[model samples]
Target chain A: GQQVMQIPQYQHVQEGEDFTTYCNSSTTLSNIQWYKQRPGGHPVFLIQLVKSGEVKKQKRLTFQFGEAKKNSSLHITATQTTDVGTYFCKGGSEKLVFGKGTKLTVNP
Target chain B: GAGVSQSPSNKVTEKGKDVELRCDPISGHTALYWYRQSLGQGLEFLIYFQGNSAPDKSGLPSDRFSAERTGGSVSTLTIQRTQQEDSAVYLCASSRWTGEKAFFGQGTRLTVV
Candidate 1:
């Protein structure tokens, strides 16, 4: 069995501040997918990192995969109130495993 | 359907009762998964179905929980003799393939009292 560990279970930041959440796995992963779940909403796909040491960016959000493919990170630059939600990382090849997730709250 | 759809968005049941949750995945998706999420908690893997293969039930907490996918499109998760601890949101997700990004349904919030 594989486990995905996520850090900073919860975070609260002032609007315009930056935030980062990290994900680590007990085993190497073929790919990692990121998801965002807004309050009262279901989880939505955010991005997917396949190549080792890959970095992808979407607007103010940046995602990076470790060179070993056992770790990943999501960073939000100048976060806004709309950024309040839980971010989860699913890692694996055949059977993807989801991390507990990091819940973020942005204060306006 | 435009997206994954779950029935009976919210359900309240008495303890010891049996409950069933339904999930209608997007057409053409080959992978379906069921997960449980307690309040302020992470997603707990429950079961997975891939095509016509036997489902992976390792994540099931007990014999009380079981799920089945029929015709490779719709799924049903049943809990027998439910307990108060079963209260949580049951989420269903589907992906086009084994390793692709998943699309999740709104989820069925179950409360066993």
Candidate 2:
């Protein structure tokens, strides 16, 4: 079994500001996936990183996989109110194990 | 694309009763998963299903909890002799195979009185 810990547990950012949440795993990860769960909504897949040192971008969001493949980060640039949600990272066994999640609040 | 869909979005049952929650995974998905989320909590892994292979039931909390997948498509999670501690949101997800990305359902909110 693998475990992931994400930070910061909660974050507040002004509109147009940037935010970053880091995801770390106790054991080496085969792959990592990021998800966002909006208030009153289900968790939606954001991105997946498989190779070590891989980096992917989705518009304003930049995701990076560490060289050791044991850590990942999701950085949102020029955040908007719509970015308000809890961000989670899953890194574990063939199946995914999710972290506690980082709740992001944007003040517009 | 049809995402994972769950039935009985909300359920209220008396303690000691049994309840079944259903999940319909996307067509062609070979991997399905069950998770729980308490109020303001993160997702708690419950079980995993992959093709014809044996399911991973290590996350099951107790003998009162059980789940089964039929024809590699739909899944049902049954909780017998439910207690107040069993109240939580049960979420289902499905993926292609191996370590592929997962798509989640809205989840069933269960409340035991």
What share of the reference contacts survives in each candidate?
A: 0.75, 0.75
List ranges where model 1 is wrong by over 4 Å. none
Model 1 agreement with the true structure over A1-108: per-residue lDDT tens digits:
467899989999999999999999878988899999998888999999999999999999999999999999999999999999999998886665689999999999
- Which lDDT value does model 1 have at B57? 95
lDDT of candidate 1 over B1-113, digit per residue (tens): 89999988999999999999999999999999999999888889899999999999999999999999999999999999999999999999999988899999999999999
For all candidates in order, the CA lDDT equals 0.94, 0.93
* TM-scores, chain A, per candidate: 0.96, 0.96
Docking class of 2: medium
Tell me how large the interface RMSD of candidate 1 is.
Answer: 1.0
Query: Which residue pairs show backbone clashes in model 2?
Result: none
lDDT of 2 by residue, A1-107 (tens): 68898999999999999999999986788888999999989899998898999999999999999999999999999999999999999995477678999999999
A56, model 2: CA deviation in Å? Answer: 1.1
